[model samples]
Target: MEFVAKEKGFIAHFSYGDLHVSGDDEHGFRPFQLLVSSIAVCSGGVLRKILEKMRMPCSDMKVTAEVERNEEKANRVEKIHLHFVITGEQLDPEKVKKAVELARKNCPMAQSVEGSIVLTESFELVS
Candidate 1:
């Protein structure tokens, strides 16, 4: 991964593609947004795999993240809340909860920021 400084911000070139990041929302994704997205997507992937291994058919899944930032000091992220909406047939709530727990424990991104930031997860199973 490499970043080239632009007039407004920077363009990060990765194996996948280029990402334009800036403090301005109109320009591109903010750095903090990227961090939140990484955590959410990482956990979502793990959760999906866990459900699949358990033979739970997930027709659709969406992971959304809400971040709380500290008002004082540097305004860093204080907490992240992940909400998952999973749609399927005959989805057991208990099993889905277990999968979410396992995902939180196993997600590398979540683990990385565990001590510094508070991470919370909740899920809804839709039939």
Candidate 2:
């Protein structure tokens, strides 16, 4: 597997194992970070959409990922913990939980990574 990224303007070419990334800024982490970001973003997006559709009116949503690395395998993230903090007004807890469950079911990224990766979810509601 190979990935290639050509410079559009500011960043240089980047190649990785089936994933490519480039940054205009110097502080970019790596391609693995991009994968984590993608998962987090996808989960958040699905949850937000589901909540909104349920009339929950999500005022704020945050997904924080804590990745556990393999000690003997050169620091590769083997498992991930996804902590979600959802803020809204007049929200039903049961509906919120259902939305999260639906989001996990419908999230493409989560489905793609489910077999090979361990993903844990915890939620908090802000009144």
Candidate 3:
């Protein structure tokens, strides 16, 4: 991906659209926010797939990511916690828990940050 400097930050061009990235929130999406988003979304997607493959498809899924940064270490990312809200009927919590573990292991983004950032997951089911 190529990024071009803008007045406020930089814009990266992709087939879908342009992504604005910067340190300042007003300028664009902060780098840390993007990082956390990528990990959360990747894991969520993988989890969804696993659920379907395991015959536990959900009607809807929403993922929220919470990030922890270390101030003493130049504000680097220390951990990311992902919470998933799944809406469906008769969804077994045990099976969902298994899927979560599988997702964390299969997700490329999660695996990429394995040694560096701590990744955790939780979920709640709605009928």
Candidate 4:
């Protein structure tokens, strides 16, 4: 991974020709948003795989991450709430709950910020 500085922000170049711009909101993605996205996407992917492995049918999934920042302390992120909406057929609430728990426990991004940030998850199933 490498980053090149532009006039307003930096462009991050990653493997596979992927590029992300990080800077002010007007220019590109903010640094904090990227952090939250990493956690959300990681957990979402894990949850999806877990559900598939358990033979749970899912047609669609969406993950939204909300963050609480402490303005007094350098505007640091204090908490992150991840809401997952899953659409499927005949979904079992108990199974979905278990998969979410497992994903939270196993997500590398969540684990990295475990001590410093409060991470919470909620899910709703649509049939």
- Put down candidate 4 lDDT per residue, 1-127, tens digits, no spaces: 6788888888876666645565578888899998999999999999999999889968999999889999999999999999999999878999999999999998999999999999999999998
Candidate number achieving the greatest TM-score relative to the actual structure: 3
Better of 2 and 3 by lDDT: 3
The stretch of ten residues in a row with the least summed lDDT in candidate 1 is: 1-10
Off by over 4 Å in 3: none
> Where is the poorest 10-residue window by lDDT in model 3?
33-42
User: What does candidate 1's lDDT look like per residue over 48-107, in tens digits?
Assistant: 999999899699999999999987968899999999999998889999999999999999
Please give, for residues 1-127, the per-residue lDDT of candidate 2 as tens digits.
Answer: 3444455322334463233354433434465676788888999999999988998887888899998878798767678888899988988888888988888899999898887778878899997
Better candidate number, 1 or 4, judged by lDDT: 1
Clashes of each: 0, 0, 0, 0
Candidate closer to the true structure by TM-score (higher is better), 1 or 4: 1
Which candidate model has the greater TM-score, 1 or 3? 3
Please rank every candidate by lDDT, starting with the best. 3, 1, 4, 2
The alpha-carbon lDDT assigned to residue 93 of candidate 3 equals: 95
